[model samples]
Target: NECASPQKYHVDCDSNAVCVDTEEGYSCRCRPGFADISEAFNRLPGRKCVEAVNECLDTRLNQCSENAICEDAKEGYICTCRQGFVDASPNITHYPGRICNKPRKPDDDHQVSHQLDSCNPKDPRCGNNAICTDRKNKGQFICECAEKAFRFDDGSCRLSAACDVSNDCDKNAVCANVFDSYKCQCRPGYIDLSPDPETRPGRYCKELVNECATNAHDCSPFAECIDATDGYACVCTDGFSDTSSTAGLLPGRKCSNSSNECLDRSTHTCDDNADCIDTPDGYNCQCISGYVDVSSSANLPPGRVCTVQTTCPKQKTDLMFLIDGSGSIGSYVFKHEVLRFIKEFVELFDIGLDRTRVGLIQYSDQIRHEFDLNQYSDKSSLLHAIESTHYLTG
Candidate 1:
């Protein structure tokens, strides 16, 4: 009857316990697994003790927060701080605990290299010839043309270069473009037979001289000949083959023909107002005022006269000479010399073919008028007529 009472706390000697209102007779004993129900919080119910409740089994009734530690108790478990940081929320006897700690450690976003600064999408740090790339974990800057490509003056990359005369090639060689470099190509009649990387890296490159090409034969007989682009030439072809065999062409050993070794102008000994007159093996190039023939040849460059602005001489000559013509000029040289003299005279006067009058008189014992004074306009006609003279007698 006492054990059957309601609303009043009581227990039996058999270790059975109950809370009831009224009891026939009251008794104290253990409840469930308790050895002593009177002080179940710290003791056993009679000869029995309360079974331990697994607080960690079901997190709902006695839930332990992520920030706390759980410990088993007779009827529940408790939570506490784990490590590194303290729990910001206090413990609650009948509720779950709250978690509070320092901010979580920041993650490494730059998988490439975190030491570098963050990349900018607008003005990237990559160089002019490089590419700016932003990757998922990090950013990178790479050269666009690879390491082999050389940088240009404009901060761009070029596979080849603009070739000029100053490159490390023979005088007969020209500059050509190659991958990331410039190549020295032998002119038409020249080639590089060597297998040197500086010259003959490919089948088409060789170091050899071409002497039999067009215009190369235009050089006088006995003159050394060589090849040139668009043409070939006769000169001191060999650097060491001057007439004197000097370092280059010089006095006593000049770049000359069979006619006059002195005409071979390889040296210098003349005034600025004079012309070089050939002697034997060397020449003296008279540097005439207002004239420059660094490479003095019999054929002077068309003098840069006062053409843009004319300066006619104060003195003028209208008289002309007519010679006797027996037949024709005897030899080729004589004829050429005569014609050359005529050309020189005309060039000296800077005469216009339409401005002046010329006359021709060819006499072979009996006088013959080839042309009248008023018939020819300029010195060219007179020169031509004089050059056409034929000698019949001495």
Candidate 2:
């Protein structure tokens, strides 16, 4: 009668346990392999049975084979063949408990080159602009971008980045990626001027100039001007050419009349018998100390006929030629000796308007004046007059 009692009259127990009624009372017992999940109860003490936690959920406890997957089961866990893997023996199959073995190629020697091969698509290798190669002897593979290629998430590749780091520019320039290729540029203040400006990094830093050294300028005939960064200026135009180095003229100045460029033997046109005298404008040629210009005109070209000054008078002094006709001096000695003495004395002064004045007188002859000191203005004219003078013998 109690076993046939209404559901409400039946003994109460854990949902996972069966209720057993005895003459004294009712007790709770776990089902098949389940155990009481609750150890302590808040109220009445009784077994609160529940299905045991599947140990397979703890992968550590139910560690399946490398190629297998652990699956939770009614009583415990089961190891099954993972996707792309198969059991060692087809007939040895067990529901949710099959042992897994790595798949083998029809051509057994065709080993996969990478672990990712297990989840590989139809075309496991990389696509355009990418490379797929074996990692090692193991059945595994690695996919990477090829030379100058950029890889996308979808495993596709595209050409790009001919350069990566600055070194890729070979230290010749700055490098930039233009999506498809590398771009190089020179730095500021640098210029290649070549057809292609991106030649090297050095081209960017190369010095650029407007090039003033070669152009001509509007300088004086006595000066040579050269180009400078700011503008142009006279360099070789300074009158002090004699002191300037042969390399170039003194910087930042103009030529002056006082500059004696002719003093420098290397730059003068005067003859050996001539002297180079510097003028404010340029230079001039003059007869040397021991020479005279024989040209008809006072102004003569360089290398002209030059006679010796002969220590002859040169313009600025008073000269007198005195003759002695005394009886003690014989007529022969008087003519030769007296004449010789006059000629020699005359040579000591310069004969010119601004130089010496020459005169002649005969002694013992009543002091007759043959010529006055103001007679000739030049040495040549005075010398000629002296040669033509007649001898007065007393």
Candidate 3:
């Protein structure tokens, strides 16, 4: 009856103990490994069996995790973790259920190891032309292009020059970089004729034509058509020239009347005491002022040679004089003094085409033509006619 109902008495025993019913009274005894600190049987009058010492309650005796739960046992204790907790130590054999740690998820950032062992040195495992790097998080890394290289449009890595604008091309032509080279193209008004795909890709601006060939030119009438690279020129003809040379090379060149280029001595055959005259064909030479040549039998050579008229032979000479007769000097002074002066001057020359010839004229407001040298053959007739000449007043 005691084993069946130990609480039926005035006292009760702990569940860890067994109750025995003697002939005299009921007694309480602890089960195996259990100890009773309270002497419940020694209680006065009636035995009080409610004292049991729990060994699991002592931290030294209970081996439980900091996050685990400790249960009381009869003689010892058992340590175990909560429903979702686990051991924190890497090796859990020695400290199973002693410390509780949350399970690490591969996707969780906090679960990642902060040590430098994340990257495997032996196996970088990166793509071609790429480098691997392990930054803040261990066991994780990123891939990047190698040195002096970049990513291409085809998601490929290559070694080549980088570009952001067309100016980076050769000769400032229109071009862009490819995988390991560049592609070239011609600009407006320029086209490629002979393309060599073996040496260079795409067309180059090498074979250029005159744009004016297809377009109208504003060249002047005096200009001629000249074909040039990438354009046409409107150049002045032989008798004409432009002050601006670029006008011909470019556009808007207008040919104008060319000035006499005789000033350039090297370009002309004119000699000293001569004048160079530019002509449509070439150039011509003429004697200068106050110069005459009596040689060559009255037929002047087409060149520059001059001598004083006084030094010429008498045959080439034809002389004339006009004496001022305005009311300043009286007719008496005119005939005597002036006539004497003339008489003396005429005696010094041989009067003929083969020698020398002479004529005379007197003028005030009106002119008097006495006689031409051709009218007389000898000096005696000329002197006789001069004496018979008449005088007039203003």
TM-scores for every candidate against the unseen true structure: 0.24, 0.26, 0.25
- Ranked candidates (TM-score, high to low): 2, 3, 1
Kindly give the number of clashing pairs for every candidate.
37, 27, 5
Model 1 TM-score relative to the real fold = 0.24
In order, the Cα lDDT scores of the candidates are 0.43, 0.52, 0.54
Q: Which prediction has the highest lDDT against the true structure?
A: 3
* Candidate no. 3 TM-score: 0.25
Cα lDDT of model 3 by residue, 1-394, tens digit: 5556655654466666667777766666757655553322222212233334564577776667666666563334445455434434332322334565433223424433332223354677655655777554575666545553454444444533333322333442444333333445443334454256344523455644433333355666676656565556777777666644444444326554565658688777565677888854356787677665322221345554454445444446777877776678787877766765565456545777556777888788898887776777687787676666666667
After superposition, candidate 3 runs with Cα above 4 Å error: 1-129, 135-143, 146-162, 165-168, 176-182, 191-318, 323-394
Which 10 successive residues of model 2 have the least lDDT summed? 37-46
Instruction: Give lDDT for model 2.
Output: 0.52
Which wins on lDDT, candidate 1 or candidate 2? 2
Q: What ranking of all candidate models by lDDT puts the best one first?
A: 3, 2, 1
